[model samples]
Target chain A: MSSPERSSTPMALIVVAWALVVIPLLYGLVQTIRTASALFTG
Target chain B: MAVPGFLARDRIVAKPGFNRWLIPPAALAVHLCIGQVYATSVYKAALVADFESSLTAIGAIFSIAIVMLGLSAALFGTWVDRNGPRAAMFTSACFWSVGFLVGAAGIATNQLWLLYLGYGVLGGIGLGIGYISPVSTLIKWFPDRPGLATGMAIMGFGGGALIATPLSRQLMSLYDSSYDGTAATTPSGSAVALLFVTFGLVYLVFMMFGAAIVRVPAEGWKPDGFDPSTVKSKALVTTDSVSAANAIKTPQFWLLWIVLFCNVTAGIGILEQASPMVQDFFRDGDASLVTAAAAAGFVGLLSLFNMAGRFVWSSTSDVIGRKGIYMVYLGVGLLLYVALATVGSSAVWLFVLLAALIISFYGGGFATIPAYLRDLFGTYQVGAIHGRLLTAWSAAGVAGPLIVNGVLDTQGTPGELVAGDYRIALFIMVGLLAVGFVANLLVKPVASKWHEPKSQTSPTPERSAAR
Candidate 1:
């Protein structure tokens, strides 16, 4: 698993990692903005 | 290295060229899964009907898990540092998901104690281990910015709840066609069993992503262009090591414990009643200014602040020292509570802004504490210290709710109460924040007598020698 040939992280692993983190944060951000707007307008 | 216990160790170990940024997502995977514990309320009513139990009886499940989380973290934090993140995370995966599996069985068989034992005790041990598994490794890797590293990971715990709550509600609806996504309706017992099993299976894969990728830095590794001396120069920051055992003996430790306790007590006390509090604040005539949906929106807004503050304020502590950051959390927190007591009901915007800011500081307090521990103690047992410090959180979890509810009960029920009803509790929150403020002032650098000798700076597998 720690071979010299496998020096770089796989592309798939990088994509999954970014997706896992970025996706939820974006969703939460979008939802929060919506609620925040309502807080003032209400 | 060939042993079963260390199977994924080599796979996750970072090679020379590996980027440190890759680590946070791995940590996020584990945290997001366990954060589902906060989503339990979505199923509480469902379980109440399924098991024919009172809401208080069901609420005890989450309570036991949180208590166990504190205990297990304090107990097993050192084991995590010694054995490495992979081993600790894998063990966490087994305990956490298995706890859910056992809980599924309990639900199926209608055994309440089994639910308590399964989800409460076993899952809690998993939460504690899972919570701290990445902390030591992340700190060691990013010694340049310990606050940012630990905050990124701890932030996930708060974020996890956000993801789980909606997902669980949707899943419950899917499982029981009759569930209309409301509080009154309970999903089918079989559906709950299925939900438990699904969560267990999903979380295993998610947590393993972290376990499979997490690696400790080699002895004395530092990031490019990072100055080791600069970190040391920051106020009250140190490279001096304190054993987790000795750390507790230090006045700094108790000071931090009280600091964390008060901050948490105030925040959790308010947060536990967020939905109800919003209605209580603005309720006037028969038709209150704040409706249920608006109240829910306010709760959602607070959750966002709660989660984001974990990353934003804690990371800010890297630039502004941990002590300064906590001063803001406590000092400003006291002011906000006062405003909420005196002027909160004057305008909806004022109430919302103050509550959100207070929650952000609360989240910041949690994420910043480990780095705070690192500054006063050192990395050698920072995870363990962080674990022990979490007992403050468990204590606050109980005390916070008690303070809020006791006051609220005497004032009036949730909907009938107005801002006046909350004046007493809000003042108490101010008093609690002042205590934390005083504790922060008392914290100074640890004494030289406690420092680990220079030769033993590198991590050792031996627990007795390591701390």
Candidate 2:
């Protein structure tokens, strides 16, 4: 089977792609700060 | 006359669908996890407090891990290329997970050597393999967009600490009963062990996802609308593909190595002592405004800038070209270091901001160099060349911390709060960046002798027929 061809420059796709990347990163960041705080305090 | 068949087979290129994207993310997942090396200071502080160890003794663990990262990467890089990223990544996952588990056990038992062996030696192996695995594959997939693609994967590496630093701190807190600053009252050894095991399992799964999705494009294939000429015209020294093996022999490779070594060493000096440095700077005769929590937070903020630089500045390289990008990293980086040395105590915010920018450039340097190599050397063996160049990182890892801590120690005032103490170290970093700037300027195009012209040989009938 051939590779699926999506629009190369779709705004929606780019937005979704960025969202996927950003959300996990932000979540990770929150987790990091929370952990550091606990370590320092504990 | 003797062996046309042997020569033809050696010249044959592998078909596409070798799994490129899968490799970089796989590499990233492991690297991001191993990037915990940056956060080892937190553990060191805890160890120092709990075991009542000397700073030099505590530092030995981190030093061992870093030294091992360089040695193992150089040794395993060739293996990854020969065996493929799957085996290499899987091995990395195993060693890294075990290292954490071993470290957890060491903490429970209060056995410092085990922590050193586990995290330093075992985990260091994971770092070496994970780092080099996806580099060449990413370059292959985005031969036309090497900087951006390689940057995407490597940027994750810079960000890895951003995630690990805080997460580890949290995990330590969760497992411990008391929230005391003193390390002696922290959690049981078994609790730390459990956390390591959990982290390992999660990392293994994420890395496997990356490995499963990676595929190499067909040989000579370009993205449907991509133009090779556009890439060549935009880059500093354009060349057709050269395998990673041959790429190292060229002057461009050595110049790139010097650039990375300088950038990494400069950034690491600050990173190694980020928390203490912030505390010392803001400390006054009456009382210090910078709390331990704030210092850790500052480290996290630096991590944010470090991570951001990796993605943003390196991606910018795709547009402005790698050489132009390095000029920014080196030139702007030097200015920021100078500003920090001079204006650091007078205006605290400026020091923080400038320091963040310098750290970002440090992260950006690591993320961007892969693309720089892709620009000068073909993707054929970029991984190997990148692997070889990592010896510079190994060297800087030792040099950076030694310069920072050595200066701090020799001053003979561990508890004597002072801002001017770090001035000499900052100047040292400035000189290093200057050397890097000169090395970057000296980089010339790869000689034509190194290029592999297509006309020198014909394609195999079987491969051509398949296409």
Candidate 3:
């Protein structure tokens, strides 16, 4: 079940795919940290 | 014929140039949407008000969803392996979104059974299918780093609550002006109904995006500079593939099941009561030193640790090996429970730090199990095995809270409990972790008798590749 020769992928597409998921993830991380910080201050 | 042609296993095979990295994001899309299950607490109060129901009645919705998650995963696991990730993802999206829409109708009409059928049964099925969809694909793509690959995807499940909690709050606030995202206020049923519709639509887009972009690797593809033979050199790592049907017969699978059940059961002792537990620990005469807000913040902090551990500790398994990593999760976890029971209340920082580490280990156990299974059972039907294993989690979900809450109930009434009231429950968790540690120790490579025949197991050249 050997595959055919590998082909080159566009770097831009890789970056776009990653950013699509990462952006929402970062937003959530920031929100959680902001809420959790109250553990110390409150 | 039930599955569309486009969603077929063969149709979504990676082209020669397909970048393997694109797959993780696609996996994350579905995980993040279904992970909303954990964030159901955000709306628990509103549902109670809407139905004029007791807290237990409302809480049963979440319980039902979790129970169905286990059942559906076990029942459909082999079908998922046979059909492939795309079909599974699409099926999940349809079930999940329709569930929300049906739940919206339930809320709008004040019919509780519809909500139970929709979110609890249908949505739970989505959660089960979505949870395992990408696991085997990720393992195949990064056989050299299976832990890291699965970790990246599963981490989204933990992190999904981080997004959904705040997002749900904001959406509810938008839908109802009277609600301020606080305990003092509750959103109207109409607001919640609209919120479900919005969530249903949004999740449909994200999950469909995942199903559209996901691809299985080409047959026999390997990453540059990665030697498949080297993977077998690791302890308990198998080159041979086992069928999911055969996997359940092995003692190793049951051992890992116990390991996961104990780990999750112990973690939920803290998670199930995070808010009130912190307040009770620091109680001073009539009022606790910790405020309600701080207790909430502690829950948020635990969420961060749980999310971080899923990625960090699971990826570390790639270096340390899965068995070594689980020893740390189970062995050290037992001692941490002891410390938490004894001196955890002496200081707030001490309590937080101990619980955080335990929760991290808990998350690590969940994220690492797939890689562990891949090592022991091989990847022939790992997604199916993973689905089967998750029944342990469902069992733990019931047992963990029952043990904690039952102990607490016997100690004293809810609002009047103190640090002493919790010791018995915490100690019980310590005992559960001890059992898990021994289970982890007992796990070994599956016997050759359990392996699928080579002719039946081997991938054909035209078949899309799986690990």
Q: Which residue runs of candidate 1 sit more than 4 Å off their true CA positions?
A: A1-6, A10-12, A25-42, B1-13, B463-467
Q: Lowest summed-lDDT stretch of 10 residues in model 1 chain B?
A: B1-10
* DockQ for every prediction shown: 0.40, 0.17, 0.66
CA lDDT, candidate 3, residue B58? 86
Q: Candidate 3 has what TM-score?
A: 0.97
Report the interface RMSD that candidate 2 achieves against the true structure, in angstroms. 7.4
- Let me know the DockQ for model 3: 0.66
Q: What is the TM-score of each candidate against the true structure?
A: 0.95, 0.83, 0.97
Q: In angstroms, give how far residue B412 of model 2 lies from its true place.
A: 4.6
Winner on DockQ between 1 and 3 is 3
**lDDT string, candidate 1, B91-195, tens digits:** 899899999999999999999999999999999999999999888878888898888988998889988878777667778889989887666566888888889
Q: Per-residue lDDT of B315-424 in model 2, one digit per residue for the tens?
A: 89888888999999998999989888888877656767888899889988998987887778766556666778888999998899889988888665755656788888
